[model samples]
Target: MGNSFSELIKNFDKTRDYMRDFYIYGFKTRNDFQYKSLRTYDDERRRIESWLGDFIKFSNSKKGKQISISCDSSKIEENPLYNAYRCKSFTKNDIQLHFFLIDILEEDNFISLNDITDRILDEFEISFDPQTIRMKLNEYIKEGIIISRKQGRSLVYAKSPDSFQRLAGNDSDKITDMIKFFSESAPFGIIGNYILKSLDKLNNLFLIKHNFIVHTLEDNILLALCQAIEGKNYVSLVNYGKSHKKTEIKCIPMKIHVSTQTGRRYIIVYNKQWKRFSALRLDYIKSVDILEVCPEYDCYLEKYQKNAVYCWGTSFGAKRPKEGIEYIKMTLRIDEHNEKFIIDRLKREGRNGSVEKTGENTFCYYGEFFDVSELSPWIKTFTGRIIKLESNNKQVENRFYSDIRKMQKMYEVK
Candidate 1:
């Protein structure tokens, strides 16, 4: 049909791949994408422009016109990238049947499948097989768009009662506020953003600080991992590292950890074969397939929770001690008169660690974690105020000093 044309997309992964490229490595001409046709690039660029015209920008480069999306996450309440999820492809029959079925059930009457099909042929002058109509109706039933009841020997379908009016009764404003907050704060918040769009509402009520816009790229992968964890299922996934080398792993999905400082996300999973827990970055996961349920899911979950307090971040540590623990102690010089905030910070970000006063304007922080190395960066933050830092792992302790010596050499410090 002269190169089929449609604005909506069928495969979201293709859209996601192109969108991520555009979002991450912007300012590229169509010629930059040597693998795809110019037409393909044009179509996707057009599609994204249609969705995020406000954020789309163009500039002239020496080679050609460059297209890019410029979005300020802190300036906007909702993620515009979420628009990619809302554009869905539909066949001619699917669209036609949707209107026909909704128009037929508009009168609040239950109609049998055969009768519905006949009405479409007669009233709408469109004919679809009765079985096709039945399947469509069943699909709608599962989606809560239609309700069905047994009528004699046949099943009949009718439009489900709309709950929008009920939602608008009293607490609708509060509900909208909740959704506004959720759309920016929650994982898979694109769903909430879609709901807000359906309701024709704008988020004028809330603003999220430190919102991580790039994280929306990993939502689809996160959704799969969450489903697997919730069902206590094993997942087989393709993971790739910085070098883009692929590795296949089968593990029990456990938890999702988000870093407050960097806004990166990781999926914590347990590998039964290795008998160890490891965290994989969400972005590194290429694909995931849900597998059979893990019968020892609860036992593994309890063990993880018990040992989680010892985890500095997502790592279970390297060269774990025989006792499965590592210790760290830091003494910081604080001006108790004015630097109580430092002590408060040590207490706040210490996780399961303890802080106690050792002497006037001096405090000692003791922590036991699965990996003391992971805490090195955090410890470095208190560089000037650090009186002494010690770790049970000599490598971790020496590495800290080694880094300081390198910095001193670089700065030509005496």
Candidate 2:
């Protein structure tokens, strides 16, 4: 959005990087910092504490005063950042101006800037300057919170028309149901929350089992990234590495990928300087700016696709094929009559694994992947059923046995 947002309130999104970096990688000492200034860190730390006071902790040691967040983030129903983002703070002038302007404009009648300022002074004892009121109203108009129109030579203002009024005559029951489902389910569901709240009948109907509330914070960045990807444009990303250090990179954003298991999201970008594909975790991505459209972006994907088959996670890495692309094939012994469930699950979870019967109760699976090691966990699920497992990479097969032996030794000792 515009500069007017976030600053008006001591919001969490404003101090996002300050809190997240520190939360993930806490400060052992005040001076050991990547932030520009100590004053900047103090300001942001205080802002973060205001929202996450419950989770904040401090310690005194040889490393000086250390700050860290203590919470099991996965268990939280809503992201605390979202809760703070929703926390709206206002100045004394903001409160008075809203009431003075809204009370007059509630009737849907438009009036000039002079009339509004006069109404505040004469009707409410609040003496606000006419020029100041005009500027304030202009900000509201830009935000679409209020409407300003030129009625002949004089400019007039009013509260923007209610969209609810247009939907009032339609099939309300159906509309309310649709609104309830989407408001709880869609990204930026908060945007639809106001409308959903208006329909009291729809309240508390949805008890989402797997709501990813933190995804709401990523909506703006995701939109920008997706827009750049669709337009085939380069983007400048300010991101943090595993070391919790800041770095900026210019890359062509090729695609967005999400994990079905965890619902974590990532953007796969091709780094021209490194001449390879790198997947940036969307949660770790601080900000993105779409650069000019690039014609050669898709050419990077041609190389990426060859390697993507081996990518078990978003770790496509900085270069190709010392991280070799290989063929992986396996044979599982599944009795058709007794193991319909296992057979169905294998088919459902297998992205592109081909299934064929090689013997009476045995089935063969064939697939090509860059890294067969990635499929180890899924392969382990079929422990007894895996009669034969072969791959071009010998290390993968050896690691699988090593894991199984370690597990056996632990259980035997127990």
TM-score of each: 0.88, 0.75
C-alpha lDDT of candidate 2 relative to the true structure: 0.73
Worst 10-residue stretch by lDDT in candidate 2? 1-10
Q: How accurate is candidate 1 locally (lDDT)?
A: 0.86
Give candidate 2's TM-score: 0.75
| lDDT by residue (tens digit), candidate 2, 1-414 | 334323225544555555555566675457766456876666666666777778888888787888876666445533455544556787788788877787877437888888888888889988898887887898888877799778999999889885565556577677776676676667666655656554544434555655555566677778889899889899998887778789998999877887756667889988879877778888878789999989887677676676676676676632565555666678888889999888888787777677778989888887766567768878898887888888887987888778878988988945
Q: Model 1 clash pairs?
A: none
Q: Count the backbone clashes (under 3 Å) in each candidate.
A: 0, 2
lDDT of 1 by residue, 277-334 (tens): 8999987888999999999999999988987888989988654434758899999999
RMSD of each: 3.1, 5.9
